[model samples]
Target: MQKLRRYLALGGLSVGMTVLAACGASPTATTGPAATTAATTAAATARPSTAPAASATIAPAGVTRTASASVTTPAATATRATTPAAATATRAGTVTSGTATRTGSPTALVTPSQAVSNLQRLDNSRQTWAFTGFTVAGLSGNLNPVFEYNGGNQKVTLAAGGTNLEAYQVGGVLYVRAPIGGVIQADASNPLAAPAQTLFATPAALLTALVPANTSYTVAGTETINGLQATRYTASVALTDLGFVNPALAGQGGTAATTVWVDTTQGVLVALQSNITAAGSNTAATARLDVTQIGQTPAIVVPR
Candidate 1:
């Protein structure tokens, strides 16, 4: 699979106009900003009213008496009495509503590593997916592969040099569909056989090997891909994290801008893209992979 590896180099497979209407000239500035100011001098006299004040008397020992002039309306009194209870009820309702929202919406994965982990878990189940990838190393190539997994049986349609090659692995043997339409045992001679065996034989182990730990990433946003809602995450990952051992790239591992999409509903990995570069080399490798069809894919049937 040197051709495939060469095509996927980089640790392998680093894949308005808002219109505002003018409001009627502000009514001609409402009389030109109103007159500056006007003052008039006038004489006045102050007088005190002869209303009787509340009487207060000194009480006996251990007693106290005080007087004041304050009045409240019936509506004001009723409002003051019920305000606390109303506020308490509103607070309780708000808390309940917030809790419901948290429970109803899917919990977002805090880290990209967690998203990758979820991908592994979902990839192991009985599901189907199609991955389309493009890589640039020495040769620029595109790969579209559809995979179907059920229990321990799997089938895939691989793309190679404009040929749709079908492959099936059952009971520990890789079988390639011949041009004449029967099954052929895949040996070391076929370029795609080894890679297919390595990739499909162990479920999602390749994914674990592909994405590295210690990757710094953040949640980019949410997007819809292949009819599934997915959370997008962006990160900077070192080529070394992907197991790139090129002598031209060393130290800090030469970072790559990486982004991944995971299904918002089930946490399954939906898509990924990476742009990788070497330390001193001008050429860069770009790759993208997207998984679709999910649990709705048809069953894979071994060729009779």
Candidate 2:
């Protein structure tokens, strides 16, 4: 199994807007503006939102997004759901609705290193899980691209911005549900035209693309995301390390500080955030993912 080297698809996926510079390929995942674009474009089918898909890179967009997703289950996966707030180990009081809480417990899990080892182990094995989250990019525009992945034969849905840009994937086939448009089939011959598949082509592919490497993970304490108690780790990696090297971002030497939350009890990655900085800019490029569930995989069937 291949590791998620290029990691983040760090683009807001602006509908028609272009990023200052292009991103490079990383070792774990090869994400950039293109991935987000594809996500947004396909997601448009469901609603009006998301960036445009011209390639496989994550395009940076404006706006800060917390984790929320709408899977493809007819009833259970109908609406977007938020992570129930939990008390922080360092902060005080129980967090209500996305508010911060206080506590003092270290992030629970194996050693930070061990947590990563578990991540690697999971990556190497055949598994099923589900995730719902969004990525934020762009120094100016607030573009939030959302995606939901259900492993095991793979079922995914993507949407971004606030417009009706949405799409989904099942098996190897993809479908777009544009607002006024009917169901659009994905064309493998010209992937860029239907790059949404790049985001959820497979469980392993999606995990490798969504999860970061453990090389830089360090225990950062415990936090709650979506009502789940998860151990958090902080790390810093080069933009190129995750496959993000852009003339605007990496040209100035792209470096990112990331926070990750893992469900130690279940040995699964639950949530993560990345703050990317360039040598020449004051603004930081940020991206995030919050896993909604693991083990109890949801059913993601292809669209008709």
Candidate 3:
């Protein structure tokens, strides 16, 4: 079996929008601009003072083996073994040849070290930018989210009035706090370490981290995602460890395969799809992010 080197990169982006409009009741009688102005003023004065109203929308969105053996001889055969020496040598040679055939050439099982080196080098010099936008799909809700990072440190800001939530890292610790109601607070904690920190902490940050770093992964095939051509790379990896669907997630166990799609020319990841099989069933989820607009630089707040 060939030794396969697989790296699973995960992340996603979402856009949402909310519009506010102020409408005035039809004039009770014919009115000119002056009359309208007076009516507006009167209405303003008549209306009771109130706080600003806010709304928010949110879209939240890869193995090998080896074997060895030992041999032992009985103590009773210590004196007269010369007769079987020739036969033993022949059998040993055959066994060695058979083992080689069964296990395959050493080169077949090992990836060129240069590939790993290239991947790391590319990752080191990678350039990443931040993005913030509003996304709306029909009428589910509006998502206004912000992300900040230089391919590593990330913070996410989500605000939808009562559903305001924030997640970020500080001193390598991940903290997520959200309001359950008008005044209730809830929080969840994680190790906030590498790999996990890189992928789950921020979607944009993870995108930069997952870009192939000169690590040559065999292309699985080509498929269309959201009407765009996407290339899929298969890496031998553990899905759980990669943070695709871990126990921390509600229904993540038994995830089998993960596929990522990137635009061949732009080198931007357009979509990510994962198929998970748990409890004798299969469930799949997909995340799609399109760069409708790009910003000069993302505004991120790093927690102390």
Candidate 4:
């Protein structure tokens, strides 16, 4: 279970920033709800992993905010800058990386059991899934909010739904369509692609991608979802850092923490939640991705 959470956290952090860019925010704006902040001081204090630190900050108002964490590095911090905000809306937290910290917010008070229940409900509610949403909260520099993945020849789409975005994963690839013109591409050519498509292709692959390599996870406990009992797992990992892919993001004091719920009866992920903290500041954002609608099975394809 722990391994599952960690992998989901890592994959989510990696793609969170890129997806945000696809939402249509400019490259220079930093004050909106989705703005990236500094890393959480907590993550910096943890044992260093083989991967470089990936962190950012999120504010409470969903407006301009920044966070930073203390880290010793030879290089400077990377910044993901977006342009000015055109309008104001309630924004959630950004997803970053770093140590864990506690806040007085209601979301922070969520008990481990409650978190599990949320996940179970999400999983039980959807058999076939569609839609995707990404959020980043804590970091120190600028952020680009967009991500894209290719599955052989499958064409995917991310539909705009108010503040939340929807995704459709066909074939073996995933596509993200945002309010903005931004797009992201990732390689999802894995041996498990076929089986995953039968379950919930995009969501399943997404959950699997979040797990770190060579890690172990176990179901820790169970929670009831609408009278049905669901199992929960916890995993721990030191993820491989992808900061080198964009040097501009190093030393930004961001940390990624996420929780996922899988229905014990069916063994499928139903809900995903994440929190990101910036390094120095108290700013952070929390995001939740629930499977609201599922689509009928389509012709499946395998990438060469």
- Candidate of highest TM-score: 1
Tens digits of per-residue lDDT, candidate 4, 243-290, equal 321223345544436555554444444455545444565545443444
Counting clashing residue pairs in each candidate, in order, gives 3, 67, 10, 98
TM-score of each: 0.54, 0.46, 0.30, 0.29
Instruction: After the best TM-score superposition of candidate 1, give how far the Cα of residue 229 lies from its true spot, in angstroms.
Output: 2.0
> Sorted by TM-score, highest first, which candidate order results?
1, 2, 3, 4
As a TM-score, model 1 comes out at 0.54
Residue 300 CA displacement from its true place in model 3, Å? 1.8
The candidate 3 region of ten consecutive residues with least summed lDDT is 60-69
Report lDDT (Cα) of residue 169, candidate 4. Answer: 55
What candidate 2 gets wrong by more than 4 Å, as runs, is 1-140, 161-163, 178-181, 189-192, 201-216, 241-252
Model 3 CA lDDT for position 28: 38
Q: Roughly what TM-score does model 3 have, to 2 decimal places?
A: 0.30
User: Candidate 2, overall lDDT?
Assistant: 0.47
lDDT of 1 by residue, 183-232 (tens): 77788896657656644633353344335667666777677876777778
Q: What is candidate 3's lDDT per residue for 1-304, written digit by digit as tens?
A: 1223222111111111111112343333345777899989988866643312211111111001111111123333543476588789999999999778434332232232222232223311222222222111111133444444323444545554345555655445565543332211223333222322333434433333233343455566566655555555544222332233232344334333434554443344444433434444444333233322222234433433
